[model samples]
Target: MIVVLSAVLLFGANIAQAEEPLYVSVGQTTGNLYGLYTTSNEMWAVATQRCKDLGWKNLVFIKSADVTSEVYDLMYEAVGTAYYWSPIIGMNDLDNEGRWLWNDGTPVSGYTNWGPSQPDNHRKEDCAALEWPFNTWNDIDCGREQPFICFQEPSEYKRSQIDDRLFSIRKFDVEKGTQEMARSGCKKDGFRLAVVDSDAVIAKIEKSINWNSKVGYWVDGTHNCLNADNCEGSTSYVCEDVFPLVLSNSREDYTVGNTIEIECAGSGVSTVNVKWQRQDGVPTDNIWNEPLQKIEPGKATLIIKSATLEDSAKYKCSAANDIFSPSRGYVTSINITVHPEAIKDAMSP
Candidate 1:
């Protein structure tokens, strides 16, 4: 009887074996790794929490318009064997009434995959799902359970995408801030203040700024100087043969009070001149700079604060004298975007 019971127990254990999880690599260059989950058709809310518990940042959501095709294929492969209720994205009208927000804290702009007049918010349906047809987004009830797509670190792919566009030679305007401040801000977000040496680039930059109705960007060019034309005889200098100073405008992200820093990417930190400037083409009276906070040689940190909407803008870090000769300075910048959730708390005095 004991031998027979042991055999039955072993057989039951085999029957309960779990299926192997499937893995997919996204963003050919960005290399975003994801795991497809199909253990059960758990509630959208429950699956979201489970994905986080399973060691992922959040659901496999779309960040850019160009990613729709890649995401569609991944979802099709994931649901091949099981016809479960797994959603590929984490989006809902949970916080506000009509607007759907992404789990990654970004706007869901550009590409969409709504199933023909769907997302009617039927029965107060808030959660998004990729149902039987696959490749389409459906606004379903959050209580409904489904398998989901969970992804690893997303900032890597986001950063890589921005890095690839760095040399595009367009007028990469930031929201606001002076040249030095913009330079520092851009480095934090994986971009540099653009270096425009051609009239075509200047025209493109000017058009973008005017169309957006925002202040102009501080490029690596003398103010008032446009395309071999003394033009306005700008006071700014542009050195051609100066040792290039690398500035890091990483990922352009921060909470209130976060220390925003920009450092020299290479040599000449000891004698380099670094300053923070804003977008209005002015260096004085900016909000981030402290009158008494002794500026260091290699890097400068600004404690971001402010409750108003106008607080978000571009900042540039200008390195001159040593590498920037006779006023010719190569500059870089980053845009400082404010977090909607953190804004109120950050602005609290």
Candidate 2:
């Protein structure tokens, strides 16, 4: 019953086929693949389905200024030097007019580049597009056929469920192996040993397993009942996977006497928690001591009012979600140097 329920909730129904669309690789950033669907021009719904047919969860969702730049470049090159209308992507306001949301149902906030007088939602225009040449976003009718961009992050192992799948579960058995093998085995199959975050997942497993058996199972779970073990030997393990956490637009060099700002954006399964800390300095783990820090759904920004000689140190940004293991959080760092002398050498214009 759970399998049947999950199947219905997780995967999409098969749709009619269309001419193969050309997928041009835009570029890989932080292990994620991005590309444009050049050939076929389809309606908003069709474009969404086209990407799903190819196992890409959605059309590209721009989260930060850096990602926005990358998307603009991809579109510009895809359509040659000429100006085009726009690329049909996942952004839309269909659910609630005037409130644009990504395909994943997250609201658009923090960063946006809309054309002048754009997203006027003209004539019931519900879908969103990235306009070429202008390099801005515009609202368009959902029925208008336009080419779109697709995004994907290939998993390292065999997958029973893709990124689009919701609350799906699977298990694997090693018969006789160490916890490392169990984890590695899951990875080889494109999964991580299950970290039971909910009762629903474990309940499903209980019904299927011989609870009285002598064989031990491995799970990075939270329940006290699942006592921590040496993990030296386990015969069975549960496997689960999500979009791997990736960081972008990080690691820039800065000088002293100038105000400094660094941002770290993240992409992964769900709500990604981002943090910044000094990696090589007196206030190492105490990031709260920083002047200002801003946080959004999947991004974080660290600001320094003015750089000083003492501020010349390495600062690190870390991002993780509920799904990530302790060691698997995405991390990036920046190095700052307080060069007041360089600032003093500046000539007045």
Candidate 3:
């Protein structure tokens, strides 16, 4: 009767509703159409309207499991070739400007987004991936090991586990100086040199030691310019920090009459000294003997009275101060070439 018919209809409707697949709403469209994708873990949905507006043509799912069969094939197909290594898309690569492009040589415009400073070319790493919330792309190195996302065909009962953890370093302002000077600056800030590896730390320390002055001594946390062992345990003020030094407006080749000016500075120290030396000249005993004008607190100017090809050799600048316990120094060598014309001109004058 009527009661029996009502029960049948109600049960049928319940079964129909249960059979309908659940789709995740990524965004939405104006109409009933929902942009959807199914993966082993999650069903994602995007509004049709938003998809159309953003020009997003497809749903990219980062498959967490068995990516080898699904996304890997897509990557190979997209590149029109097979790769020896499994391709992963994620943060580091995205920061480095690595991207996935269609085999037809057109950019896949709407698929990628990236975080700031992402894909920095750290040691030439390149690859790109999409991260969540921001939905941005990060460029990374292919050889680097990291997690990845994968997409799969539609099916019901899919769910996504989003990783909300963000691994990042706090941004801070760095005082500008040479590598040595910068290290001292860091120490002043309660930090040591920002080297990631032991080898780099050793190399930096050794370089600082080798460039120390002959008469200078190392202070606690300061660089001992003189390669003296007696002061290994004794603390004294000396130049040993790694700071960057640059020489401007100096010619590679020098001759009689070529005027050379040298300047140096660092984050912590002020006042730099410039000296000129001849490698193999008449005064072999007086190699470091040239008396030069000292610029107060950071710079010195040295002018070669007359240009001569023999004036070419190594020029040294020793920069030091008492700002940090251990001071710092940097050395740069330039090959000087004196043109014959300048030599002849000097001879005539």
Candidate 4:
């Protein structure tokens, strides 16, 4: 019975292993044996054999499905050990220096494995490596580029079709209610307002009104009337589609203890409400009780006598009216830092 049970367990493990799919090999290049891998969908069997003949170990395979087609194509063109002397390019090494950075210039935190004292800065080495036993990196000289392996895998392509019968209605010249337009416009587009086909148009119109109009109004696209003859002027408008809401001015960043001025602007917008609150940690209830100052119709200013670390948070400005929903609401954040007297004195008064 013990022998039979052991055999059963071994068979089960083999089955599980077989279920795992084999990854594809796309290309091979040489560098400082940086273990970084990328993908392409195609395989190059000849290149794999050549690497084996060259006694190259630690082959890194890149799965094509894991990356964009453009990247895959680049790897496919460079198959074999001939490119071994060339630099092994990874997403983080685009600009070299071994410091992997995102396209946005943000330093990629974590995901680093380096050999102890490996980057020893020997003679200003800038290239990096992914060490074995653990995939870590150490900066090395680019001149020491070595060979690397790449892989690709097949993927499925699934295309979805959308209905083409949908149409859109846009306000051209004046403020129009979004709710009314959505209801009336869907019928002409051969769909209902509830359908997904109308969501884009509805969102566009709502954002426009929310950013542009101070007065709230409802647009019913389902309305069939040619003009405002049947529409309720007090609650709705048959006005032509116009530009969406726009910010009156640019936003400026501030530190604690600094006064801030916020402005909201749009064609039909007037009064705006300004609210300030903390972004994280405990919320303060007394902020509202402080005397709020209004600078002008659609403008407000907050004066911080002496800003504190607790003052760091986000401020919101919303402009609205009865004819339309809040036309525009803008958010700006402030960061506070406690500067030492020496640093503060260094600044020009």
For lDDT, the strongest prediction is 2
TM-score list, all predictions: 0.37, 0.41, 0.26, 0.26
How does candidate 1 fare on TM-score? 0.37
Note the Cα lDDT for every prediction shown: 0.47, 0.57, 0.33, 0.32
Residue 325 of model 2: what lDDT?
Answer: 17
Candidate with more favorable, higher lDDT: 1 or 4: 1
Candidate 4 weakest lDDT stretch, 10 residues: 1-10
Query: By TM-score, who's the top model here?
Result: 2
Kindly list the per-residue Cα lDDT of model 4 for residues 1-349, writing each as its tens digit.
0000000001111211122111121111211111122222112233233333322332333223222222222332223113222323232343655565532355545443345775466776644433321223455454553443422212211011011111122332334445555455433322333322244433433332223243323344443332233433333322221112234444343444555443333232222333333323221222223324444544444455555555544443322222221111223323334333345445535
Evaluated against the true structure, the overall lDDT of model 4 is: 0.32
Query: How would the candidate models be sorted by lDDT, starting from the highest?
Result: 2, 1, 3, 4
The per-residue C-alpha lDDT of model 1 at residue 142 equals 84
| Model 3 lDDT tens row, 154-220 | 2321111111000111112432223455345445532333332233333333332223344223323
Clashes of 2: 3
Superposed by TM-score, candidate 2 places the C-alpha of residue 11 at a distance from the truth, in angstroms, of 17
Candidate 2 error regions (>4 Å): 1-23, 26-29, 154-349
Question: Cα lDDT for residue 126, model 1?
Answer: 75
